[model samples]
Target: MTARPAKAVSRRPPRPARRTSAVRPPRAGRGGPRRLYSRVRRAWDRPLTAYYLILGGSLLITVLGLVMVYSASQIKALQSGLAPSYFFRKQLLAAAIGGVLLLAASRMTAKLHRAMAYPLLAVSVFLMCLVQIPGIGVAVNGNRNWLSLGGPFQMQPSEFGKLALVLWGADLLARKQERKLLTQWKHLLVPLVPVAFLLLGLIMLGGDMGTAIILTAVLFGLLWLAGAPTRLFTGVLGGAVAIGALLILTSANRMSRLACIGATDPGPGDQCWQAVHGIYALASGGFFGSGLGASMEKWGELPEPHTDFIFAITGEELGLAGTLSVLALFAALGYAGIRVAGRTEDPFVRYAAGGVTTWVMAQAMINMGAVLGLLPIAGVPLPLFSYGGSALLPTMFAIGLLIAFARDEPAARAALALATRKPVFGRKPAGVRWKTMRRRVARRPSGER
Candidate 1:
C-alpha cells in the first residue's frame, strides 16, 4: 500500500531557482550625496526657482542694504549736523520710488520694454550730456557724474546709463539677430561697440572710471552674448584695456588710485588711508563681527563707509558671516540671472539678462575688490548695498528687469498661472469650493438646509 501511494507523486513543476547575484537598485533617499544631489536637482528644476531666486535675492540684498546704510550713515550724518536718519530717509524714499518703477517695469510687456528702450536711451543720453554742463552737473567726491535735481535731490546719469545700455543693447542685438546680421563681425560691433564706447567716453569725461568699467563689462557681455568671434572679442577687449591704462596713467588721481592697490601703509597725504582702514575694518571683524552699528571704522576712521567702503563697514559690524551672506546673495542673484538668460528662447531677454548680470556682478567685484585692497579704489558704490539714491534706484529697476525676464520663462509663466489659479496650498480654490457648496445646496432637499 505504501509503494502504491509513492507511485502516485504529484506532477507539479519544480520550484524556480532564486537569482542571488541579481543587483538591487538603490533605494530613494538612501545614498547620502546622491540623495542630496537629487534634491538639489529637483529644486533647481522647478519652474519658479529662478524667479524666486531673483525676487528673494534682490529683496534681501536691498533690505539688508537699507539696514546697513542706516547703520553706517548715522555717524557721518551726525558729523555733518544733520539728523542721523537723514541718509537713511533719503535712501528709503528712493527705494520706495524705485519699488514703483520696478513694479511698472515688471508688468510691462516685452514689446513695451523694447519700445521704452529708445526713449530710455534718449533720456539717459540727454541727462548724460547735461552732466557735462557745469551749471546742471553736480560734482561729488571730485566726480562730475551727478545731476542736481534741485535742492537735496541728485541723480547720476551714468547709473541710468547702465540700465540704458542693457536695454538698448539687448534690443539692438535681438533685432539684428532676427535679421541674421550677427554672423558678420561688422554688424555685431558697429553701432553697439561704437555706442558703448561713446557712453564710456561720456562716463570718463565725468571722471567716473568706475562707472566706465561697469559699462565696459556690459558692452563686452552684450557682444559675447551676441556671439562675437574670438578675435573680435579679444580685439575689443584689448582696446578697452589699453584705453583704461592710458587714462589711468595720464591722471594724477588715477595714478594715486592705481598705486594704492594692496597698500599696507597710509602713504603721503593719506592716499591709502581708505584702503588701509578698509583692511583694518575687515580684519577686526573676526568671524561674526562686532555687532550692528558697532563698527569703529565708521566713526571717522573709514571713508565713504556708507557707499564705496560699505562692505568694509559691513565686515566690521556684521563680520565675515555677514559679508559671506551678502556675497552668497549676490552669487545667487547672478546665477539666477544666468539661468534666465540661458533658458530663454527670446534673444532680447537673453541678452538683457546677461547684460544686467554682467553689469551688477562686475560692479560688485570692483567695489569689493577695492575695499579688500586687491584692486584700485574705483569710487563706485556697491549696487543695492550702498547709500546713494541714484545707484539704488537704477539697480532696483534692473533687478525688476531680471524679475520680469524670469517671469517670462515658459515654465515660470505656467507656474505663475497655476499659483494664481489656486492661491492657497493644500486646499481647493475658494471659487471651486463656493461653486461646489452652491451645487450641493441646490441638490439638497428644502428641509435639509
Candidate 2:
C-alpha cells in the first residue's frame, strides 16, 4: 500500500504548463499611426480661399507703387533741390512700415481685435480733437486736417477714424446680436447714430469731406449687414445727402470744387487747377502711356503727385494700360474681401470683414472718380499705391485683417497645405487599430463568454 501511494504521489512533470495568450506591445517599425496623425493636423492649420487673391493683388500693387513713386517724385525731388530719390525713399519707407503693420494685424485674434475696438475708437477721437487745436493741427492744401509731427511725418486722424468706426460698428452690432436686441431701431441707434455723428462731425470740422464720405459709406454698409430697417437706412441716406449738399454749398472752396467737377477749362488760378492737371495727365497717357519716369505733369504741373493725385501719376507713367491694371488690382481686392465676408460662419467676423472691405473699395473708387473728374476731389489717397504714411499704414493694416479672415476660409487652408506640402504642427494622429481586435473577440466562442 505504501509503495502504491508513493508511486501515485510521483509528480507528473507539472503538466506542461497550459499556455495563455499575453497582450503584446504594438509592433515595431509600424509608424503608420504617427504618419496618419500628422496628415490631419496639417489639414486643420491651412488657410481659407480668399487669401490667394489678396496676396496676389498686394504684390502687384506694391510693385506698381514702387515704380509709380519713382516716376511721380523725380521732378518734385529735383525741383526741391534734394536727391532724385527723395519722394521714392519716403514712399519706400512708408511702404515698409505699412507692410510690417499689415503682417502684425493678420496674426491678431478676432477677440483681441474686438476688445481693442473701443479703445481704438477713443484714441482716434482724441487725435481728431487734437487736429483742431491751434498749433497742434497744421493746415495743408487748404484743409486743417493734418497734424505734422515732424519731417514728413504727419497724422491724419481721419485715416485712423475709418478703422475705428468699422471696429466699433462691428462690436456694437455683435453685442446687439448676442443679446437678441438688434431688431429694434432704438437698440441700434443707441450705439450707432451717436458714434457715427461724432465721427462725421470731427472730420467735418477738419474739412475732410473725402474721409467723411468714406465713413458714411462704411456706416451704411455696416447697417445693411446688421439688418437695419430699410426705411431707417433710407432716411439716414437722405439726411446724409442733404447735410453734405448744405455743407458744400455753404463753403466757398467746396462750392467752387463742385462747380469745376466737369469744367474742361477751369481757367488759370481757379480751384480747378489740380483737377484740370489730373485730366491732362490721364489724357497724355493714352493706352500704353508716356513711359515710366517720363511724366510731364509731375513737373510742378500736377500738384500732390505723390499724395491725392497718385493715380494720375500712374496714368502719366504707365498709361491707360497701367491705370487699368491698377483698377484690376482693386477689383481683385474687392473680390477677395467680399469672398471673406461671404465665407465666414461667424457674424462678427463677417461684418468686420465687410466693413473693412467696403472702406477700402469705396475709398479707392472715390480717389479714382476724383481723378477721372466723375466726382469732386475728396483728397483721399489710393490704397497702398499712394505715398502718405497715415493712409498707407491704416490701409495696409486693414488689408491684413481682410487676409486674416480669408485665411480662416476652408479652401484657402487646403490650398496652403497643397502649396507648402508640409505639416504646420508636429504631427497628426493615426486612428486606433481596433478592427483586428474586434475580429478576434468575435471569433471567441459563446461558451467562453
Candidate 3:
C-alpha cells in the first residue's frame, strides 16, 4: 500500500489537507453595516459609554444652537444697525463660558458637590431677590427675572434658580433618607416646599410664569422621586392646576397666549401674531425645509427667530425634518438624563438628575406644544439650543453635573483607569509583583521536597 501511494505521489511531498479555520469573529471596526452596528452595540456595553453619550449629545446640541443663532439672527442684527454676527458673537461667548463651567462641574468631587449645595441655593435665592431690587431688577418680555449688570449684559437669575433647587433639594432629601425621615410626609414637605414656594413667589412676582412653571416641575419631580404619597401629588397637582389657571387668567399677556392656542379668528390678532407666524414658518418649510438661512420667516416674518421660536425657524429652513431633528435631539438628551438618573447608587444623583431632567424636558415640551398650538406659548428658551446666555450657562453646568454622576459609576471608574493607564507595549513590567516575588522565593526553597 505504501509503494502504491508513493507511485501516485508527485515530485513534491503530498500537500497537507487545506486547514479549515473555525468561524472567526469579524474584525473589530470592520465589515458591512450590520457588523458595524453590532460593533457599536458591543462598544456601548462598555462602562464609559454613558458618559461619552452625555458629553457628545451636549456638545452637538450646543454647537447646533450656536450655528442656528447666527443664521436666525443675522438679518435682524443687520436691520438693527448692528454687526451681522452680533447675536452669534454674544452666544459664542456664552457658550465658551458655559463649556468652561461644564468642565469644572464634571470634575468636582462628591464632597465638594454636597458642600456647595446650600451655597448654590443661597446664591440662587439671593440673586432671585436681587432681581427684585429697585434698579437691579430689569424687566424683559414682561418678566422681571433679569439682573441688570449694565448695557447688553442682563442675566436671568431664574435660570440659575433651576439648578440651585435641584442641588439643594437633592441634598435635603438624601440627608433625610439617611435618617429614615423621608417616610414622614412632613419631613418630605418641609424646607424644600417652603423655600421653593418662596422662590416661586418671587418668580411669579416677576411675572415670569414660564420660569414659575419650570420651577414647579422641579419641585414636584423631587417630591415624586423621594417617594411622596400619591395623594400628596394629587393635592399638589390640583393646587398647581388652580394656581396655573389663576395666574393665566390674571395676566393679560398670559391670557393672550392662551387665546393664541385656541384662537379660531381667521385673521391673526396681535395676541396671536407670534403664534401664527410660528405656524407659518413651520408649515412653509414643507418637509425638508425652506433651506437653512433662506427662511423668509426669519427675514422679519417670525418673531424670535433665534430665541424662543428658533424651533420655528428650524422648521422653516429644514422643514419638518429639521423640527423633528431638534425634537429628536432633545429626546435623546432626555433619555440620557434618565439613564444617568436611574443608574446612580447615590440618592443625590438620582434626585438631582431627575429634577434637572424634569425641568429641561418639561420646559421643552411646553415650548414645543405652544409652537404647535397645543398649549399656550410660554417664554421659555429651548434649554441648550436657545440663544440665551442665562439659560445656556446653567444648562451646560447641569449637563456637567450629569457627567460627573456618570463618571462616578463603577464601570466609568474602570474605563477611566483603563484609559489613563500607561501603554503596556514598551514598558518594563515592575519585575513581578512583590507578593509574587516572595512566593517564587519560597517556592525555590520548598523544591527540597
Candidate 4:
C-alpha cells in the first residue's frame, strides 16, 4: 500500500474578473463627496441605519411613556393615599430592567438566537398554562392572564408568549428555507399554523382577546412574509374575521364595545365611557395641548389613563404636537423593523423582524383606535408607550433583537472592522494609497517607484 503511492490531485484555475462596468456599481463621476447632504445621506444608508433608528425611537417612546405614566397616575395615587410617584417608581424600575434586557439581547449572536428559540417556545407554553391555575392566575378586570407570584409584582404570561412565538416561528421558517420546504403550501402551513392556533387558543382561554389579536397579527405577518398563496391568505383572513365576529358576539362587553365604535354618545354605562372621555380629552386640548401633567382627564375623568389609554392622556396633555411626535416615533420603529426585514439575507431575520413589527404596529393601532373610537375597545397596550411592566420588558427585548440584526449587516461589519483597526503613527492602517502604492511598487519588480 505504501509502495503504491498517492495520486496527485489537480485543481481548477480561478476565473478572471469581468472587465465590463455592468459587473460593478455606478460611481459618481465627480463632486459626489462635495455635497454634504448627499454624503450624509449615503453614510446613513448603511447597514446600521436600522439599528440607530430603532434605538432612538424606542428610547424616546419609553422615556415619554414614563413621563406620561407619572402624569396620568399621580392623581389616582394621591386619592389612593399612596405617594404621587408610586406608579412612576414602579414603571421606572420596569424600564431599567427592560433596558438591561435590551442591551443584552442587542449583543446576542445569530447562532444564540436560533438556539434559544425552541426552549423559549416551550417555556412560554408552560407559562401560559400556569396562568390558568386557579390560585396562581390572578384575574384583572375580566382577563385571567396574569400570574401572582406572591408579591406586588405580577407577570403577564401572554406577553412573553408573544416574544417566544416570534423566535420559534422564525427559527421554524428559517429551517424550512434551508430544506427548500417553503415552496410547498402544506410544508409551509403545517405545524406553524397549528402551533399558532394552539397558542392563540390558550390566550383566548384566559379571556385575553386583545393579546390573542396581537398574536394573530404576528401569525398573519409571518405567513404573508413566507409567501403563502393569495387564496390561502384570503381564507386565513376570512377565518380570522369570522372568529373575531364570533368572539365579539359571545361577550356582552365586546358587543357594547362594537356598538360604541362610531358613537358620539356611548350612553349609560362606562362600557364605552373610556372611549368617549378619550375623545373629550383630545378635543379639549385643541392644538398646543394643555401642557405636561396638565391633563384634566387624569383626574378620574378617564379610566386606565396610565395604561391602555395613555395615548389619550398624551393627546390631552401634549396636544396635537405631542401626539404627532408619538406617532412619528412609532413610524420610525415600524420603518426600522420593516427595513431590517427587507434587507437581511437570513430567513430568521426576515421572519422575526416582520413578526415583531407586526406585533408592535398592530397593538399600537388597536390601542389608539380603541381610544379614538375607530375600533372596539380592545384594551391592548401601546408598545413602548404604555405603562405595563410585562409588556415593556419583552418589547424592548424584541427591539434589541432588531438592533442585533442591523449590526450584523455587511456594511455594519465593514464599518466595525475599519473602526477597530489601530492606525500606525497618525496614519491609517489601511487605505487605497497604502494598498495601491505597494501593489504598483511590486509590479515594477525591483522596488522601482
Candidate 5:
C-alpha cells in the first residue's frame, strides 16, 4: 500500500520514447570528406592561387636547390682543389641575376613580350650557333652545349633557346590565331614546327638530345593548345620519335646511353657507371634519408651529384621525403601554370603558359627519369633544382612568365589592386587617408559642411 501511494505521488511527465531508427541529420560543417573537398575547391578557385603557387613554388625549389647544390658540390669542389663553396657561390650569383630577369619579365606587358620575341629568338639562335664553333664552344662531358663567358663562368644557349622557343612559338601562334589561320593545319604546323625543328637541329649539333627533347615538348604543347587535329599531332609526334630513335642509333654515345636504361651494372668500360651509381644513391636513401650533408654517394661515388644526378643525391641526403617534396613542388607549379593557361582569355598568354609548363615538366621528368633508371641519362640538369646556373637562369625566367600571365588574369589583377590599396608603412588603414582627410576637413570650417 505504501509503495502504491509513493508511485501515485510521482507527477513528473514521462520522457519521450527514444526512436529506434539510427538515421540522423548531418551536423553542420561535419561532412568530413565533402567539407574538405569544398574547402579545397574554394582555395583553388581563388583568383591569386595560381600566382602565389607559381611564385612560392619556384622560390622554394630554388632555395632548396641552393642548399642541395652547396651540400652536393662541396666534395667535388674540394677534390678539384677549389674552395668548397665554389659551386654554391656561382649558383647563388646566377640566382641573384636571374631574380632581376624574373622581375623584369613579370612586369612586362604581353605586348612587350610579343615585341621581344623576335629579338630574343635572334639572340638565342646566334648564341647557339656560336656554341658550335670549335674554339668558342666549351665542351662539357662530351656535349658542346656550354659557352665560356670568360674564366670559370659558362652559359648554355640551348637553355635560352628553350625560353625563346616558348615565347616565339606563342607569339607566332597567337598571331596566326588572330588572323584565323590556325583553322588550317598547315598554318598550325608550318613556321612553328619548322622553327622548333631548327632549334632542335642546333641543339642536336651540340650533341644535346635532352634539350632537343624538351624543345620538342614545347613545340607539341604549343600545337596542342592551338587545337591541332589529331592526325596532324600524331603525324608530327611519330616523325619526331622516328628522328629521335634514328639519331640515338647513329651515335655510339647515345646508343650507349640508351643501352644503360634500367641497368644495374656499370657495363663494359663502366658505360653504365652513372646510371648504376644513381640507383645506388637513391636506394641508400631510405624513407627519411641519410640526413642533409650526410650522403655517402656525394663523396666521389656519384658523378654530377649536383647537376644531372642531383635528384639521386637529394634522395641520398634527404631521403624519399625530400625527393617527393621536390616532385610535389613541381606538380604544384605545373598545375598553377595550367590554371593560368586555362583561365586566360588572351591567346598569347594561353599558348605561352602552356609551352613554358611543357618545357619545365618535360625536362623535369627526363632528368628524374634518368636518375631513377627509367630512362637513358640525358645529361640534363633538373630544372631549378640542379647546380648549373645556365639551367637555373632560363628556367627562373620561364617561371616569371607564368607569374606575369597569372597576374594578367582579370580576377587576379583585381585581387592585386586590392592588395596594393591596403595600408602599410606609417600610412593609415584603408578608407582613411587620415592625414589628408584631416587637412581637408580642417581647411574647411566645420560649419561649411
Candidate 6:
C-alpha cells in the first residue's frame, strides 16, 4: 500500500497561487453608516432655501395668528358668554388639519395634481351651489356664502373655489398652449367663460366680493402666463376694473367703507368703525408691537380681528417689525412660486404655479391693504393667519403645491432634500421590481438530436 501510494503520489505542481487584490469588497449598497453618509452628502448638495423661507414664514404667521386670535376673540367670546379660547381652539384645529393637507399636497406630482384639477373644480362648483341652499347656507354678518356643517364647522366654498379656479384655468391654458390654440379667443373662452361665470356668479350670490376679485386676479395671471394678446388682456383688465368700480358704487356698505379710508373718528357702529379701529391699532403698535395678547383694540374695540383684521391685530401685538416680517414671508412665497413656475418646462405647471402664486399673494395684499385702511374691507382673510377653516385648508394646500414644486426643482433638489431630511425620489408603488432571465436552448426531441 505504501509503495503504491508513493508511486501514485506524483502530486501535480502546486497550482499557481491565485492573486487577489487588496481592495475591500464594494461596500454593500450604501447601508448603515454609508447610507447615512450618502444621504447627508446629498442633502448638503441640495438646499431648499426657497421652501424654508415660505414654510418658515407660514409657521411664524400661524403662531402669531394663534396668539392674536386668542387675544382678539377673548373679549367678544366673553361678552357672548363663551370660552375665551373658542376662536383660538377652532383656528388651532384648522391649522392642524391644514398642516396635514399641506404635507400631503407637497408630496403630489404635477401630473397627479393636474389630473385632480377637474374633479376638484367640479366638487368646488357643487359645493358653491350647495351654499345657495337654504338651511344649509348660514348667513354670517349678512353674507349667505357660508355652509354650516353643524357645531362650529362652517365653511365657505368660495374660498376653495379660488384654488379650484386657478388649478382649472391653469390646466385649460396649459392644454391650449400645448396645442398652439391658446391665442384663439374662441379656445380661450371655453375654459375662461365658464370659470369666470362660475366664480363670479357664486360670489355674487354669496356677496363675497373679495373672493371674486381674487378669482379674477388668478384668471388674469393665467392669461398672462399663457401669453395671451397684450391688447386683449389690457382691455379685459379695464373692463374688469370698470365693472368692479360699478359694483362697489352700487353697494352702500362697500361705498361707505371705501369713503371712510382717511376719515378720523369714524362713529361707532358705522361702516368705517372697523377701519378706524384697525388704524388705531397699527398706530399704537408703532415699531416693536404692543406685545402678544396685549392689544387694546381686540377687546371688542375691533371687529373681526381674527379674520379680516388679523393683520392689524398682528401689528398691534407684534408691531411694525412683525408686520414687515409677515410681508416678507409672503414675498418669499411669491418668489418661490415664481421660481418654480419659471423652472418648470411643463406649461401646465408653469401656469398653475403662477396662477396659485397670484391668487395667494393677491389675496394677502388685499387683506393687508384692507386692514391698513388703504383699501375697502374686502372680507378677504389673511392667508395662513386668518381664523377660518375654509381659508386655511386651501391656503395650506397651495403652500404644499409650492413646496412640491420647490422639492422637484432641478437646481435646488439637493438643498431641498437636505432641508426636509426626506428622500428626493418621492414615493413609488410597492410592487415595482426588476427581473433577469437566463436564456435556455431547447434541443429538438431525442430523435432529432
* Per-candidate total of colliding backbone pairs: 0, 13, 2, 0, 0, 8
lDDT for residue 84 in candidate 6, whole number 0-100: 85
- Local accuracy of candidate 5 as per-residue lDDT tens digits, 74-189: 99999999999999999999999989989988998999989989999999999999999989999988889889999898999999999999999999999998999999988998
- Mind giving the per-residue lDDT tens digits that candidate 4 earns over 179-292? 999999888888899999999999999899999999999999999999999999899899999998899899988888888996776588656677899899988887879999
Q: What is the C-alpha RMSD of each candidate to the true structure, in Å?
A: 6.6, 14.7, 7.2, 16.4, 7.0, 13.1
- The Cα local distance difference test for each model comes to 0.90, 0.83, 0.84, 0.88, 0.91, 0.81
Q: Name the top lDDT candidate.
A: 5
The regions of model 2 sitting more than 4 angstroms off are 1-48, 414-449
TM-score of 1: 0.89
| Clash pairs, model 6 backbone | 46-414, 46-415, 47-414, 47-415, 47-416, 48-415, 48-416, 289-319
Tens-digit lDDT string for candidate 2 (372-436) = 99998888888888877788888888888887778766676656554453323843223212233
Comparison by lDDT, 4 against 5, better one:
5
Question: What's the true lDDT of residue 214 in model 4?
Answer: 94
> Scored by Cα lDDT, where does model 4 land?
0.88
Model 6 worst lDDT run, 10 consecutive residues: 432-441
Misplaced by over 4 Å in model 4 are: 1-44, 419-449
Best-first order by lDDT: 5, 1, 4, 3, 2, 6
| Residue runs of model 3 more than 4 Å from their true location after superposition | 1-44, 262-268, 424-449
Comparison by lDDT, 1 against 2, better one:
1
Question: Cα RMSD (Å) between model 6 and the true structure?
Answer: 13.1
Which ranges in model 6 have alpha carbons more than 4 Å from their true place? 1-47, 267-269, 414-449
User: Model 4: which ten-residue window has the lowest total lDDT?
Assistant: 436-445
Q: lDDT at 428 for candidate 6?
A: 27
Candidate 6 residue lDDT tens string, 1-449: 45543456656898898998787777675477888988876754444666676677677777777777778788878888989898888888988999999999989998888888889988998988888988778888778898888786888888888888877887878888889997687787676866787678888888878888898888888878877787888888898899889988899877787787766678656757888889999999989997888898987788888788988888888899988988988887788788778878888778878988998899999998888777888888988888888898998898888888777777667544433442238532243221213222224455332
